[model samples]
Target chain A: MADARDAEIDDLINNLDRDYDFHPGGKDNAGYGRDQADNKQQDLQKLLNLWIAERTCPDILPYDEELISTLTDRLRAQVEFIEMTTTDPEAASQSKLKILLVESELERIKFLIRGYVRARMHKIDKYYLHLSTQDTDTKRKLSDAEQRFVLRRATQLKRFYDQRFLSSFPQALQRLDDNSPILPMVDTPDLNEFVFVRVLQDVPGEVVLSNDDSVDLQKGNIYVLPYKAIRKFLRVGEVELV
Target chain B: MALPLKQIGTFLPSEISFLAENTSVSIVPRQALDVLELIGLNLPAMRPMRRVEVPLWVAIILKKQSRCNIIAPTWLSEDSLKAAYEAEASNMTRFSNKLPWEWIEVGELVLTSAPDDLACPPHIIRNLLRDIREIRQAKVRAGLKSLDPTYMQIDNVGAMELNEIRQFVTMTMNELRVLQNGRAEEEAEEEVEQYPGEDSDLEDTLETTEYSIPRDSSNFDDSLRSRSRSAAPLGERRPTSRAPAYEDDEGDEEEDLEMDESYLHTVKDNSSGQR
Candidate 1:
């Protein structure tokens, strides 16, 4: 039931949105229905941004639970759609061509997911010690699965070190989280690491680099700054790491 | 095993090119094709001679099959490229913000895949892009000398250019931040003096991220987490129209079944003919 092909296909593919019930007042937005195309496009862009951010940011960002779950559901539907479309005998040549397009897009999204998750896993592996001992609120930033993985990884890595070399060291030396005055054993992301950020909105106030120097954060301008200096801006969506 | 040390925190040139392919370009399909119900976005039906927007990757596929002509983005036109080249060349101290973020990747892709579709000769566009890239790269190299520990403002830097300078700029700035911090610490100034921007907001955000860093072992060790208040907002909505219909997939499945039977009949005829 459709007035045009665009509307028809929009309904066909976007039924998953309704199934998820995430768009609580699905109809509240006057034309939220037809905007599926835009939503999907935006979601893709959001995923790309996340993948880039995860790769470049010094600290592990909060896990995007809602976005990932919605996308995972859509990926499943498309996979099923592909299975149905490829087997249909009508539009044999046409369907084959369409299948190619579908498959290509499917692979693109798959690549994005793999890149995003892999980057997160790599960070988790790097910072497990810090993550394991951090406050609960800090650990909650990771997905539940990641939380489990961090614990197991941190425990196993510590055990391995103990078996390999720590057993020979003094009791005090065996501790991984030794907050030594000079140097600590735990590895943490360098918050002071420099990152390139593309400003999304004008910063509320001038950013003070020090007592004397201040830089205006204008929209649509890219700046290279320590992740710590712009961390709040990145969170408030005033800027994004390029 | 760990990721390759060098590859860590870096993207290969080819990867950037691949990412660029997702951006849309205009195309006129020579042969009509049914709609593609893709996972990411639903592409509308393509009709002959009716120009439509499609992802660059799709345009490349259609162009390779001789089924469509890619409409090069206006910026890739000879006049635009020439203008951009001149603007960039004249601005020795700064990079003119003329090109798109994906300019380098998109320009190369279109030139290679559908050169015949461009308004001017491919070489002209290629040469212009090359000239612009050269001037901008030189500027990028020179800009490193002025890099401040606080921030490096280089507008209109191409994706590829950013990657090339990424390792060097990040390392140098990081070292500078540490040295500056050490000096600031010796002065016995509070940590708030070290960071710029809204102090309260910065502290609020730091509480959420729960950082693990600093000192670099030449020396580093500190925890800077606090009470959390706000979570960052999610993706915002864009303007779109129409009251959505609440149709179930039950109808689509029926339509699929009918098409299936009809297609099976055609398949039988073809198989019979072959036999």
Candidate 2:
């Protein structure tokens, strides 16, 4: 039975990878499809269970209801989209509206999750109040109850948030293709070889260049030095050794 | 009373003859003639050398023409003057008293008094002036001393007075209400801050102590252990034992040879294991 269970687990994991088209080393590039939809749903359920386990408080539980509902609605829409795509492949091919809708829903879910986390952090401060109060039997009892509630609810909220993140990760990675690089490349210098030295202001070059043999030259006079060697020996500006 | 022509020094003989014929003698003060001239009144220039009593009719004409002296001629009898003063006072007092009350009513409804009504008629001018003065004094006593004098004009006086009182009351009430509201809001906020949600507190403590601590410590321990494991064998050059020993004739030599052989075999085994 244990072996069967292990096999089932492995199969589920394989299905998850195949359904979502998740390449462990490669970039996540899963498109909207039935298999992707199933993977997303499973991921969401796992996240929900994790969050439920984390949540300790009833009050905090209610707080996550709206978040859960929003996530569920988003997932449901994606499921419907997948079904529609399967039924009418031609229509789905022409209409990019489903993709846009999914993207918007994903963005909304992300914002909601962020807001929920912030609110939870704020509540955490309030949660400390009861613990800090004068130690009495009644107070302790109340505090214990509150602690349980918060612990349970916060855990649940975190699980849901994590699931949403996991489900959306593939889509987010695909969206990265739209991003353009904005930085220029430059060779990085080795830290150990570089050393700072003081030079006279009247010198043609303010930099004092020194080698392992203690041979020194003004940076401007070192024209024969290789670019990489010059880079190593010359300090661009004033720097403290410490 | 008739006087000798010679006794009235510098009297022209023709002027004396003219005064002597008139029964109702009008004595026009010399100041009156100066006032008439100052008012740009047209009159005959008399000789400075002559002093003459003017006829009543001529005096009346000069007085009527003069704009310099706003007061009526004083030559009239006391009874007539008193009667005229009383009539003027009564007429003015009546108009001043009635006009303000009417204006006050109109102002209560926020209506503007007509310009014709605002400009107090000639008869009631003095009374209007007195009423304006009284209103100014009242405003000062009420601590609204900075009120404009034009505020006392019939057009604005009633409304201004009403608004001033209204503003004073409204401002006082608004300030009190704001203070009260501020205090109430502060108290409510403080109460909310003090509200004790005991259950959440216990949960937080447990989460920090039981859950977070173990998880964090386990993660730290795992990292530490991995680091130590990776660094341990590198620090020591001693060959690991868990391999077959090579027997030789010399026991020490055999042990040393076994160590070297095992080390090589382990390296080979490790390489094969990696593949």
Candidate 3:
């Protein structure tokens, strides 16, 4: 965190005397003015994308904490820097106005990030059971730290369930197979995996399921099939995933 | 099995499982039949006892006409289903694949649609299917309470059941998440209230966050008036924007007067007003 602040200070100190020749209005990626705005915009865009992914794909791991923390810290430092420059009597009036614009933009982005994280935290806490039981492919959506956290939480949950439900049940109701590890017991629902597909056009062709059973698709029928099975048809607009 | 899916005002898991059940049935024509036109396919003209594939609905129709007999799938039987049910019951901590994915739905479909074809009485088969459903529902309910990941197999579970449980699990999780974030119940309520008025495009850009600025008095008044207009024609057409700020005590009296004026205007406009 201290290193980040020092880097920002170094950037400001080194560039203070350098006259920028590039125009802000021109589509010049190399321009100092354009690059600063573009980088900030990109950061905001990435944050938005992370939030959207978290909401739409419940099975996928939630956004990493480090990303949010890093963004928050960067924005805070930028805000402080802008405040110092804006109030400085030596600072040029035009540059101060530009700094103010940048400050407002940063605040807007931070507001959005804060709201997005809050909303996602709600979902993460709510669907921990389903999320924890997710396969490696889905779990990989989370950061290393989040993955470890979920594993530990899942272990704690397994122990809690075993003590509360399994152990208390009669001997006959207990599991016959003892081979499989109890913690992180696999088989929870992948909430985002299925599609409520409506058969828009008649398909005389058969769909082979995971269990190798063949199903004949017909018009005006709705079925919740696995997304992978009908993704091709969805792409061609033959089926609508409602 | 986990507890039966709660009444989430959506399709039950059983109904989803029922819809998801394979509807295609293998049938054999008892006599030479011309079914090309009836079946909507270029199925070769069947000779006596020739096997033909058709949907369950088509099979039922053909059987009703005495043109063909339904060939029950290998999975449909009293003994096999009983064994499957037993396996599911015995294995409380693991998902059982002893029965086909749509066992309960398929059994009910066959028994209800073509009972006479079965070796046993329809009622007997119906009772057996009911028993299996009850046990399965009980299992689902238990799974919910225990958060039984093993018993809560979404793929093997029916759509109705999955959707029902999904709503509950998701809702519970969201509540916990909100609590962890230090949000109160009213904040959650306010968020939900804002959803319908929110733009779909903005929702995407905001990542489903309620980032749109909170409604101010003017916008709130406009919405309230619009809602009231749609709900009742007798409501006043007062210019809500011109109304004094709602915080003023006198503003309340002016609002009441407007309502009264509108009521009186309605009565005056109707010359032959009844009652």
Best by lDDT: 1
RMSD of 3: 30.0
Clash count for each candidate, listed in order shown = 4, 21, 19
Query: Higher-TM-score candidate among 2 and 3?
Result: 3
Candidate 1 lDDT by residue in tens digits, B86-123: 88888798888779999999999999999999988999
TM-score of each: 0.76, 0.16, 0.35
Off by over 4 Å in 3: A1-242, B1-22, B34-45, B146-155, B163-166, B173-275
lDDT of 2 by residue, B12-71 (tens): 333223222222222323342221111001133333333333323343333343311122
Q: Write the per-residue lDDT of candidate 1 for residues A131-232, one digit (tens) a residue.
A: 998898878799999999889988898899999998997674566665322233456676768888999999978887644677888898888877877999
**Model number 1 iRMSD:** 11.3
| Cα lDDT, model 2, residue B134 | 58
Error of 3 at B181 (Å): 4.7
Candidate 1 CAPRI-style tier: incorrect
**What DockQ results for candidate 1?**
0.19
